[model samples]
Target chain A: MIHANDEPAVPMGLPLPNGKLAMWLFLVTEIMFFTALIGSYLIYRNGQPTASQPWPTPHDVHLAEWIGAVNTFVLICSSLTVVLALWSLHVGNSKRAVQYIGVTLALGCVFLVIKAYEYQQKFAHGILPGRVFEKLDSPHGYKYMRHVQEQLEHIEKHGGVNDKAKKACAELLADIRAGKLQPKDVNERVRGTKSIKETNPGKEFITTKDSTYVDLPERSRPKDAPMVEGILEMDTHAHLSYSIPFGNMWASCYFAMTGFHALHVFGGLVVFAIMLVMAWRGRFGPQNAQMVEVTGLYWHFVDIVWIFLFPLLYLV
Target chain B: MSEQHHDHSHGDHSHSHGDHSHGEHSHSHGGDAHGHADDAAAHFRSYIAIFIALCVFTAISFVFNELVRGGIISPMTSATVIMIVAIIKAGCVAYIFMHLKADWGKVYCIMIPVVIMCVMMIIVFLPDGVLGWR
Candidate 1:
């Protein structure tokens, strides 16, 4: 039977309807598109420098699992709505079709808004991608903790835990536990590129955040000596392929993948907006729903891509 | 209704549907409208059921993800289980919502290359695959 929305059967021997064939072809390309991206992610993640601690060590990145879960529900919910919209239209129920499409669009917007809020939180904390990634509380802070842990371990090995460095290590360890120092502290220490300097190990700040503090014994300075400052000195200009825990490879991969997916959601929203108006005008029903079906195909494909992305990035 | 007005505009065709015997009128409306309503309405319940299933799996996914983060399970094991659940969720969405279950047979032809490409991508990432070849 020739559907009102079905094209005159295609010239070729394609068994599928014209729109279905076209959508399937488009989906094929989309599959390959995501393959390139996801494949690159796997390669980069696997090819990281082999370390004793393993890749993506706990605390290396603090993804808000709750928000991610909420967004996942939103996407899945939107997929369900899209499905219902298609089915509703296929059953000669234009009113139900419009309602479902509207709900799907709303849920899609919710997903994007929550993602925006997540981005805002990360940005405030200086969690960004690539060269722009501000290591407010991530690899930078983790590195400091590891450094202090190493210093304490050294004292334990050499001086039987009674060493002076052990006391300093304990104080630093306290600072970490209390979450005393943050990206703000780092910025205050840096002040600007003018004040930012590469101070060596055991260096004290020129002006302490707390001046009345008892300086760690191992970090003592000579009287009348020129003032110095603190901040871990690491090469941020390292190549993406070489850096293990440093640099912003993880952030880069994350922004690239999630950003592209969000763009698709925006595109989907535009299509839904048009479809919502069309459905309101009573242009869609059981006899003429190929348009809605094709759009649903695209929406489902987007949902499928997110299924893999969520676990690979957040859960795994 | 717009449909009756449209039919009136084409007054030369006297039949109610104006469907030609040739069936080559490029998507002319067939004689029957809402003919498939019974079957579609019956299957509609399954759509809601699939939705409920999706929500349950979503909740399970989050709980399991939190457990993974909390170090209750090895990351590898957590990843495996999470991925399996994700695949199932995607399958339900595609097969039911996307109408893959009733889609024309040529869908297999479209899907085959996609699956092969995805598998090839995984193979290339394998430790002993072509990526490591000198």
Candidate 2:
């Protein structure tokens, strides 16, 4: 009969405990899963034509690098806490272990909150996949033109413009409906107004019912003042058009990669919560300290994934 | 023989009890008590050092990206430096924080095949997908 003093039996020729080995196996599969996602992202990113549809940088898309950096720091700190929790368990300090796990869980929550905020910013700017625009001739451009028309109608209803200006707006709306004037035309008109404003410091361009004129003294009119006034006569009220070249593909890759990663973080938080409860119950010690170590392995893998993701998504 | 028997008794006692104190067990194990304490201290110190290193690496990557944005450096240079730094940071976390260094033999056995598989995936996909090859 096997006695209490007998050496513990090795399972499947592995020195590690069954649970620890199993966790490592699970992590290996997870690594492969993430690798596949990142690989697809790179393929799509590299396959695009730079001349026709240049990939949008994070700055171009208004994604702040500092936010991603801060989140990376947070995850690194959580990794430390998780390892420290396992260390505390090994030393028989279950209280410290529980505290460390609690901190790690809280840090995970902070990361997700920041990520959600970034997503909210993207949604507010209409940067979602399939809805991004690079030119004013596409479907999204027409939609934006309609939006501008609505805003102009709202302004006219509120007596925001003179009768002549209101009539000009009505004609502009008719041209927009007939597809006679594109957003590019409006954009060029707005650009012209800005240039005129820059060149003539004291003069103000006023849009009247019939024509646009410069509010300048008769004796002080520059030689180019009439030409500037004529240029500014075109409707420039629809200056809301913007472009994000290849933003649809960029959004697709960004959301898929980071979204999966955030989901993994959430999964880690759930496991950490369970570990915290176990620590509170005094379930960890040298006798079963391997349990904490196994859990820490999973948490560290999640951190390592983010370590790669932070650079790939934000920096590059 | 007698010492081994005593150690077994302690192990069995801890296993049978609901509130086993690992610190007390190590304390009762003579020279192992001091060795375990020293090892634990070293591990704790290493964790702190790694945490600082990770923070510094993250800062370096951020700065490199800023340089690229300012047009002081090329995007390729920034990408290369950032990816290298990321690899180093990941290595630190995996080796130290994950205890892969302590159990290198066993864990490497599990990791090597996965590494090869990941490499194969990249090799097969990069050429066809990235370079526009059939």
Specify the highest-lDDT model's number. 2
Among all windows of 10 consecutive residues in model 2 chain A, the one with the lowest summed lDDT is A210-219
Score residue A172 of candidate 1 by CA lDDT.
44
lDDT string for model 1 (B1-134, tens) is 43333323222221223222111222334533332333455457767888888888877777776665455665557667888899899899887777666552447877887889789778868873324332
DockQ of 1: 0.26
The sequence of per-residue lDDT tens digits that candidate 1 reaches over residues A1-316 is 8776787744454555566678889988988988888888877776642322123422234466667778888988888888787766655466888888999999999999998986775564344665332233556545534444454355445644333334534554466557785533323222212222211111222332322121221122334545433221121211111112433666778888889999989999999999877667866455446667778889989988898888787766
TM-score of chain B of each: 0.63, 0.76
Q: Which pairs of residues collide in candidate 2?
A: A164-A209
Candidate 1 stretches greater than 4 Å from native: A1-11, A57-59, A132-247, A280-288, B1-38, B69-71, B128-134
lDDT of candidate 2 over B1-134, digit per residue (tens) = 43334434433443444244334445567687666666677778889999999999999999998786566777778889999999999999988888666556667888999999998998888775566542
**What lDDT does candidate 2 reach at residue A36?**
95
Model 2 Cα displacement at A136 (Å)? Answer: 4.2
Candidate 2's iRMSD? 6.6
Best by TM-score: 2
